[model samples]
Target: MVNLEGKGGMKREGQRSLLEKAIEIILFVGALSSIIIVFLIIAYMSLEAYPALNLDFLLGWFWDPKKEMFGIFQIIVSTLYVGVGAILITTAIGVPTAIFLAEFCPRNVRNVIKPSIELLVGIPTIVLGFFGLMVVIPFIRDNFGGWGTSVLAGWMILAIMSLPHVISISEDALRAVPNSYKEAALALGATRWQTVKKVLLPYAKTGILASVLLALGRVMGETMAVTMVIGNPRVAWIPTSILDRAKVLTSTILLDWSYVEIPSMHYHSLFGIGLVLFFIVALIDVTATYMVKRGVIK
Candidate 1:
């Protein structure tokens, strides 16, 4: 009977090993497939956009469909402007909120605040856009004495939209810091503020930067919300002020995509803009990964 039991246990172990191997193979294949799809998308975009790549095409400011001329310089400028502004605002609001939640807030308050922030992440972008249009736009117009649909409105909306992501990521980074570090600092007679500023902040700097980069990418790629608030304008250059109407790449694409004729240069130009946006997001991801890895090494 003991021999029979030992034989059954060996068989069970063998089956478990086989199942593990199968699961590994499946995961490996899925990862490979994902990588292949990404490469294919990049190749396709490059092929479509290559024809539209010329000095005149890039440098010209006109986007006339009749003339088949389209330059995205203004759109690119607006995207950068709004994206940077949004990132700055989100960082300002989110970093402090994250620090407070992670280090200062009571456990009950932290629980409530953390769940609320996570819930914000699940809110639909279109809904956020509509909210901005109805509430934020009117508030801005009434208080600031400008058109409701302006770059500033777009920036503020995008900042709010990105806040959850920035705060969550930053909070995670802060929470990941070993309690021992704080304890050691306290033992050394450092005040809470000093310990947070000198020890915690420096230790979490890379993660914080990574979160900011991720927020930047989100602000850059966000379409529906930004489109609703950006006050799309057919301008030859980026607007000089926050109150001025502007056109971002995503907004331009959303506005023009349906009307653009198939196989036309205008359509191709949109694809080219998409390619550029993709690269910008990709660059942010790569930079964030590098910063995280460098921090790990340090």
Candidate 2:
């Protein structure tokens, strides 16, 4: 009986050690796999874009494919134009909605609103594109004559698509502010509006800024919805007005994909655009990290 009890205890210890080892191995594998995947993607992009890397390729305005030429200037300008515009719109609408939800909305109202925003996030990209094409495109065409399929249309659609992410993240950030801060402000004779603008906003600025950067990243990579509404014009400058048609990086890739031959420079150019996009996202992420580390964000 003494021998059996000792053996049973040994088996239990062995099982526990095995389980711990297995978990450690699994976690290490997962982390290593993620790093490997990211590195492989960067490596592939670099290899493909290397051939076309030059001052001319980056600065040239012309993108004539028939002559086997490509330039990213126009695409870059359009990307910034659309991205900035979408960010502005999303901030204006999303931030206010977040403030309302976090500070003023009743619990019952919040339950409904939160679920609706969640639903919006759950909707697929293709469905959003279709909705934009069917509803937004026509509305712009009818009300804003001569602005058919223009940057304004794309900006509006993208702003709508970006709303859920901005609102959800910003709301979370705002709510993370300590209740004591608000109570202290109120006790100090500050009005609710003043307290929100002066205290809460300052405390939550980092989170709000991060949310905006994240939204910008989403707008930059967005293809389907923007492609449908942007009209895909072959312009080389930022659109002077909302009514002007513009060509963003994503639209250019999709528009030229079918026409480019295999192993061609145009094919390489697509990869180059992808590289540019990757770098843009990386820059945003890095900036956000820096801000967080610097104690700029609460």
Candidate 3:
């Protein structure tokens, strides 16, 4: 009987091992497939965009293919402006809110605030655009005096749209600091703010920066929400102020790419913008990572 029981146990163990191996194989294939898809996308965009890609072509602000002007520098600038605006706003509101929630707020209050903030992420971008269009834009136009669809409105929209991500990620980073570290700081006669600023913030630098990077990517890629409020136009020069209608690269693609005849300069030009956008985002990510690493080391 004992031998029979041992045999059954060995059979079950073998089955478990086989199952684990199968799961590992499945996971490996899934990862490999994602990598392949990413490479394929990059290759495809580069191939499509290479024709119109030029150093001089990208330096100007005009995009009329009929006149052979395809300068995207202003569009790039606008995109950067909107992104940086969103980042500044998000960092200001989201980081402080995160700190409050993570360090100061009561558990009951946090439970309410956290979920409410997260719900913003679920709201449709189009709807957010409408809210910007109806409420934020009107308020801006009435109060600040430009056409309601100013960069400030777009910045406000993006900031609101991105809050959940910033707050959630930053709060998690703050929360992840070991209690012992905080306790040590307190024991060393450090104030609460000092402990948080010197110890917790430094310790959780990676996650806070990760949140910023994530928001940066979202702000750069966001279409409906930003486009609706940016008052997009093909500018002849760089925008003089945040109130000047901001035409972003992604909006330019979404608004005009469908009707362009195939095998045309316009079509290829959009692709070129796409390539530039890819490189721009990649560069931002790389720069942010470098900065984070440097800060952590210091």
Model 3 worst lDDT window (10 residues)? 1-10
Model 2 ranges with Cα > 4 A deviation? 1-23, 234-237, 293-298
Judged by lDDT against the true structure, how good is candidate 3? 0.83
> Which residue pairs does candidate 3 place in steric collision?
none
Between prediction 1 and prediction 3, the one with superior lDDT is 1
Judge candidate 2 against the unseen true structure and give its global Cα lDDT, from 0 to 1: 0.85
How do the residues 166-225 of candidate 2 rate in per-residue lDDT, one tens digit apiece?
Answer: 899888888888999999999999998898999999998888888888889888889998
lDDT of each residue in 1-298, candidate 1, tens digit only: 1234687888887888899999999999998998899999989988888777776566667766566778877677778999999899999999999899888899998889899999898679998899889998898889987788888898888988999999998998988789999999999999988888998888898999999998898789999999898888654458898888888888888888878887878878888888989989989988998998898788
lDDT: which is higher, 2 or 3? 2
Question: Least accurate stretch of 10 residues (summed lDDT) in model 2?
Answer: 289-298
lDDT of every model, 2 decimals: 0.86, 0.85, 0.83
Query: TM-score for every candidate vs. truth?
Result: 0.88, 0.90, 0.85
Q: Write the per-residue lDDT of candidate 3 for residues 1-298, one digit (tens) a residue.
A: 1234687878887888899999999999998997898799889987987888888668876766567678888788888888988899999998989889988899999899998887776678898899999999999888888888878888999998888998998888898888999999999999988988999898888878878987898789888998889887754345677776778888888876756778887788888888888888877778777866675575
- Cα error, candidate 1, residue 190 (Å): 2.6
| Model 3 CA deviation exceeding 4 Å by range | 1-28, 286-298
